[model samples]
Target: MSVNARRLAAATLATGVIAGLVGLACIHLLHWIQALAWDMHGGTLLEAASAVSPTRRILVLTLGGVIGALSWFLLFRRNKAITSVSAAVSGTPMPPLRATWHALTQVLIVGLGASVGREVAPREMAAAFSAAAADRLGLSAEDRRIIVACGAGAGLAAVYSIPLSGAVYTLEILLVSRSGRAVAPAFLTSGIAVLISTGFTRPAPFYTVPTLTPSLSLTVFGALVGPLLGAAGWAFKQAVARVGAARPRDWRLLLTLPAAFLVVGLIASRLPSVLGNGQASAQTQFDATWAAGAGLAFAALVLAAKTLTTFLTIRAGGWGGVLTPAVALGAGLGAVIGLPWAAAWPGSEVAAFAFIGAAAFLGASMNAPFTGLILVIEFTAQGPTILVPAVLAVGGATAATTWLTRHAR
Candidate 1:
């Protein structure tokens, strides 16, 4: 092999290793914080949240907000800005120390019950480390971008134990590449990271579900609901972008951050499932056995709460991903829409609709249909029977979202 090729190969391996280690560390730290703050030892975050009193919930979230605010304030006090993974891939220099600390603070806040997704922490850390590794290895600019994007995807794979989805996310979402040059590195890094971190992280099928059957109703529902989810997901992305663009920057963060958490705490006191990345609520949706009416109501309530809290968290100077939040919203939307459909046409369960919704909504929101569908399948360890509907829905959602994005631009 030529010198450059060898260096690229070595860098890819290094990126995988860094991603695995970072994923392990961040997940452990997140759990530690959750256990300490909510006394959540073995149960889900929702369980611990429910076990706590209203006053305690408010206090803990408020305190978390204060800490997050102070930590961010201190991190940025030196006036150093951290570039995103995409920017870093595009050759922007990312300061290693600041980037690592910034990523850790994100995990810390999420652990302390911040209402945002934790996936971004590992992605950021992996990207930062990969950038530094590339600089040290003296890789070409093209190779560096490929390695960095693969590394970020590997971090996601390690944390979630979804190797294929990680690779798809890297190529389809981050790099937007389908060339062989990008394909091999994306899969290799993600596969290696998942293998290395599996021993420390939770097993695959991160969220469990009962056996779900695919029927005509499911196929029909998937097709019909895709456009709705697409429109909703598009609107949601725009809202979040606006809030994120205007998020507090300087001294205002202290008050705004705490105040946002205070609102989340108040809402969470009544709907404890809304706390901490949408996992609890999504799980609830997956496990739901309610009839149409009850399912619709439950889904609506949690959907509203998750949406508001996710927006508030981002708007108040909090930094995290919206992947899981999108899942929660999709599940809710699925249940809400599916309940009525099921009543009219009886075949698919509300849970089944929710599962399809999760995939379609995620695809629409991120504008990555393949990644969204693959992630949901990996997340549940489900079979391919559902893929018929899932693929159809994802395609529709993506088409709708893409059209909206283009027209808007």
Candidate 2:
């Protein structure tokens, strides 16, 4: 390798290591905060919610929103912000300290029971660190962008333990580049980050799925139902963007934040599954234990509540990712849709539909179908039996979303 290439490689490796450590730290911090705040063990936010009283849940969420709003005001409002990983990869400069603060605040917000995912913090911090390092190394703009993208990917991989999906996220979403240079560094960084994170934490898939039979009829059903999920995903993305755009900047902290939190608290009081990023709810849906009518009702309520709360969380200035909530929403929607199917086809499992819904909805929302598919596979530890139906669902969703997006434009 040439001298510059070698230097770049070393920088990328260092970035990955730093990102991994930061990701692990964020995870630990979130757990510690949850333990202290909710007096619950190390399960997810949804699990923690179950242990607390409804009144306590309301107080926690409201208090979290207040703190999150204050943090945003103090830390982010003054800074000329490049708050997005994609922006960082596109060469928008973000100060490392400011970015770190942004990340820390996100961790605190999620830990305090905000209806949002904690995935954004690690990636933003990683991007900031990589950007700063690249600048100090005096690398070219393109090189810096690639390094930042790699670091962002590494952070995601470290958190999720999905190395390939992380690398693909960098190329498909962040960098939007297919060049060999970008691909090689991203994969290396993601792999190294995953390795580092695994040393600290056991490799546990996020979701557990029962044995499922992938029949031809299921594939056909997946194809038929997938477009609804796609439309839902598209609508979700649009609604979030619209809410963000319509709300005034100053109103977010003072007016919108508390109100949104109050609404979320009210929703959580009834359906605790709507709290947090929806991991527990999705897992519940995957269990397929509820009776048909009850399952459908619960799933429908969760889908509605989660969709609204997630939108409110983003609109009210909560810092988090939409991916988990999207999966949760999809799973619930799928379960609801699958209830009748299960009745008609005696052996058809609602869990299978939930799985497909996760992929289809997430893929369509993100406009990255393969990433969604891979995430579900890694999350559930499912093999080829699930892939054919998943692909059919994902493909149908993607096409529908794409067409809708174009027509909407």
Candidate 3:
């Protein structure tokens, strides 16, 4: 190999290595921060709420959101933002300082009640730091791309402890139309990050489900729910678009924050399970009394409210990811449909439907079926009995959303 080729290889190796370490570090820092924040907030908020109302802890959720958003606005909103992971795929560089604040805002969003996951925050920060490093070192566009991809994969792998999914996400989503040359560096970083993340947390998959088979009646019934989910996805897209457009109207938009919080708080007081990520509730739905007496209309309303409030929060400049909140909503809706099936068919695959609901909702909302599917599988690691249903719903959801936008500019 030529001297220049050798130097480039060495540089790529070094960048990937540093990016990998930073990625590992970033996830741990975020987790440490989250553990303290969630615990303190959860406990204090629960205590405070219990003092007056014997009802469950719903105020804690809204209070956390208020605190997070207020801090972001008062402290961090003035900075010039950096290119996020999604933007860096085109080889653009972003400043780490900016990504850092965005990361903080994202954590705040989730810590409060914005209805999303926290992974997007630090992942973007790591990508920005890696991209900034590449720019400072005067790397080529190809190198910059690989560096950014490595950084993103590292963040995800570290956060989730799933290197294969992280690597696949970088390849399938980040490098959607790119060359295979980007693979080696990204894979290396992701592997390193996964090791670090798994070391910190249990390596077990996110959830465990009991073995359940879908009877013929339940299978057919779930298949029928596919169209309704598609419709919900379309409605969610419209709500997001509407809220995005509302941002330019005025600062009056921020009013929706407290208003939406009030409503969500009311809902959570009555239906506390809808407050946070739904993985726990989804797992326990077999015995949750809240799942009972809830009809399709109730599920539809909660789904709509959660989707709208989430969009409103972001539109009002609250930062967060859309994955978990959407999943929680989807799970609620799916349980509404699945509970009835379970009532009739004792061996029904209710959890499977809940899982599929999550994957399909995420696929439609994000327009990334592979990310949705892989995340669903890796997050749960349940058997193919569940995976098969999720894949089917994801494919259908993706096709429907893509078809609807076939003529869009």
Candidate 4:
């Protein structure tokens, strides 16, 4: 290789390693906080939450709100706002120190049982770190952008052990590039990060899923329900965007943030499923057996609570992602709809329906159909046959969301 090419390759390797380490640190920090707050040494967030007293839940989250508000205020007041991962990839500078602090604060709040996804923290940190490293290496702007995007994907890959999905996230969502140059580095960085993370994290899939055999009923369900759920997902995405656009940034956060988190705590004291990212609730839905009437009502309630809390958090100036929250929303949709379908379709599995809904909803919400599809499959490590229904669902979802987005503009 030429000197420049060799230097670029070395830098890419370094970015991947840095991404992996950042992922680990964010995760470890989150878990540590969870343990400290809820005494959650083992078991899921829901279990830990359930064991805690309602007063404790309310107190901890309220305290988190106060701390988060103060920290965010200081961070933003002291520095120019850190650009998002997409903005960074598009040539906006991401000040590394500001970005790192932003990412770490995100992890901290989420660990305190804030109702937001933690995935963005690692991705943002990885991007910031990569941009800094690339600048120090004196790489070209194009190389820096690619490395930053790949580093983000690598961070996601390391955190979830979903390498292919991470690469797809980069190409499909961030860089919007699938050329040979982009493709190779995206996959290389993600794969390397996942391998490195395996040393500290489990190699098992992110969720616990039962054996799901594809059925004709599921195929039919996917074809029929996908578009409806797609529209729902689009609505959710729009809500988040609308609230985010209006989110507090000034002294108002001191009041709004604590009020929002207090509301979440009040609800979580009753539901417990609404706390933290949507993972625990999603897992609960996956493992649940949805019956008729009551099951549908409960699922609907949980979905509503989860959606409201997530929106509230964002609107209150809490920074996070909706990826996992969207999954939980979809799972709830599946359960609510699938209960009736089960009564009619005889052999339909609600869990399988929930899984399909999750994929479809994620695709629509993110407008990244392939990444959503791959993430679901990777998270469950399900059989290839399951993809048949998932693909149909994602296709329908993509079409519906695309139409809605175009019309809304």
Candidate 5:
């Protein structure tokens, strides 16, 4: 390697290592906070909610929102323009302290049972730290952006244990680049972060899928369901955007934050599955048995409740991501659609159908079908037999979403 090449490699390696360590520390801290606040062991917020009473669930969520609002007021009162990791990777200057506070507040709110995903915190913090490191190392602007993007991907890979998807997410979503230079650092950073995280956290797939056999009938069913999910995903994105566009104010925060928590609590009182980021609930839908009528009804309720509650949480000044909630919503919708079919088809896996919904929903929402497909595959530890249907679903959903948005415009 040439002298400049060697220096780049060294900088990349250092960035990866730093990102990995930061990811590990943040994850551990999240777990500790969860244990202290909820008095539960290890699990996602929904799983932890299962162990607590309905009243406690309500209290925790309300308290969390209040805390989150106050934290936002104190930390980000002056600078309310939160820069995303993607924006940072595109040459926007990142404020390290502000980003760190943002991530920390997210972790705290999610841990306290806010209806949002915890993944954003680690990614934001990782990007901020990596950007700072790159600046100190005197790297070129382009190299710094790539490292920051890689670091964001590393944080995601560490948290979810999906290295390949993380790398793809960095290249496709964060950097919007497919060059070799982009691929190398992203893959290296994600791999390193996952490696380090495995030492501290157990290595396990996020979701378990039952064995499924490929069939023509399944493919057709997936194709049909994809567009429906696409419409849903598009609706969800619109809801979030509509809610997010409103300016944040103290009165709005005080009223909406608690109200959002109240709604979550009310929903949790009957359907605890709608709580948290929805992962535990999605897992339960995959594993548990329900009567066709009752199951479908419950699934629909959760689909609506989760969607509204997540929207409320974000609109109320709570910090978190929607990907997990989207996955959960997709799983529920898929289960509702697939249960009847599974009854007719003796060997069909409802969970597998739910998995396809997940990929499709995420793909349509993000406009990155490959990332969604790979993420679901990695998260579920499914085999290649599901890929054809997953791809079909994602493609259908993306097309439907794009067409709808275009026409609406």
Candidate 6:
């Protein structure tokens, strides 16, 4: 190679090493902070909130929504200078300090009761840190992109403890337009970050899952379910989009925030148990043995609520992605249907089907089907048993979403 080519190679190698270390520190530190935020603060708030009168619970939820909304409205509207993480990921993406601050502040909204999670804000922070650092180190555009990808992947791996899935998610979600490039540097960095963060993590399997094998007939049947789930995923996307576009105050801070608190409080207050991230409840539904009508009803309303919450925040101009709520919502859907399918289908457990539902909708809804599959595997540790239903449910969801949006940009 020529002299310049040799220097470029050397620089890339050096940058990758530095990123591995930086990504490690950033990922672990953030994970610890986030864990504390959710576990200590969020958990405390939830328990306390649950004890209050129904009216108090609604007020709490609404306040959370207001904070979340106020956060977006203030930051996004004021800082014309800052660029968003989504924009950065696509063509020449960069995460400057402005974006970083914006991301950091948004955490309160979720942590306090915004009916959302921390993944949306922190993931962006990781991506911004990686991309910005790569650029500072004089990496090429292509190289920087690769480094950013790794930083994000590493961040995700560190956060979720599924380093492999994180590595894959970094590549899969960012490759929305279907680019064939791989971010090897990012993968390497993310892997290193996971190792460093592992020391700080508590011992607990993210999700406990049984080993499973698919019968040929069940495998084929799952393939058929994909499209239906895809359609469901598409509907969810549309619901959020609609609420995002609804009239002012309908979902906005001045009006929507109160409205949101009212709705959330009303439902959660009455149910007394369906509130918060609802992950526990969603998991229960996934056990595949819940009553059909009850499960189905809860899932339907949650799907609606999740879609509305996401829309009001993003479209009404809240600052976060719809991913986590989508995950919970999707899991609920799977649980609801999984129970019935288990009872009615030839031979299958609700857990298995619920697992598939979560993966399929998560993948299809975000246009990152592979990430969905990997996340489910990482989240539940279901392994190859997850593959068949994943193919059926996720594949179908992707195809349907693609078809539904074919005419749109």
List the candidate numbers ranked by lDDT, top first. Answer: 1, 4, 2, 5, 3, 6
The C-alpha stretches of model 2 lying farther than 4 A from their native spots are 80-82, 200-202
State how far residue 82 of model 6 sits from its true place (Å).
Answer: 5.9
- Tens-digit per-residue lDDT, 28-102, candidate 1: 898899999999898689889999999999989998899889988888776836688888888888777888888
Q: Where in model 3 is the C-alpha error above 4 Å?
A: 1-66, 74-82, 200-202, 212-224, 248-263, 277-305, 341-347, 407-409
In model 1, state the lDDT of residue 228.
79
The total of clashing pairs for model 4 equals: 0
lDDT of 2: 0.81
Residues 1-409, model 2: lDDT tens digits: 8867877887888888988888788878887888987886865666778888999888888888888877777764655344688888888777788888888887887787777777788899988998888887777778888999899988988887888888988888888889998999998898888888776454767887887778766777788999988998898788777876554345347666777887888888878877776686788788876754466777777777777788778877676878888888888888888777767775557888889998899888888888888878877887468787788888889989989999998
Q: TM-scores for all candidates? A: 0.97, 0.94, 0.79, 0.96, 0.93, 0.78
Better of 1 and 2 by lDDT: 1
As a TM-score, model 1 comes out at 0.97
lDDT of each: 0.86, 0.81, 0.60, 0.86, 0.78, 0.58
Model 1 alpha-carbon drift over 4 Å, by segment: 200-204, 290-293
Better of 2 and 3 by lDDT: 2
What is the lDDT for 62 in model 6?
A: 68
lDDT of 6 by residue, 1-409 (tens): 8643443444435434443454445444443443443343333343544556777666666676666556555655644444544566654555446656666545555544455544545456666766656555666666556555555556566655566666677777654333433555445555666566564454354544566557553565468777877777777777766765553422245566556655656766765334443344444445433354565666556555554554545544445556556666777676666555655665655566667777777787767788878877777767485576578778788888898889566
lDDT of 5 by residue, 158-180 (tens): 87778898899998888889888
lDDT, residue 46, candidate 1: 88
Candidate 5: what lDDT? 0.78
Best by lDDT: 1
Model 4 TM: 0.96
* Model 5: residues with Cα > 4 Å off, grouped in runs: 2-4, 42-47, 200-202, 247-251, 291-293, 344-347
Q: Candidate 1 or 3, higher lDDT?
A: 1
As a whole number from 0 to 100, the lDDT of residue 378 in candidate 2 is 78
Ranking by TM-score: 1, 4, 2, 5, 3, 6
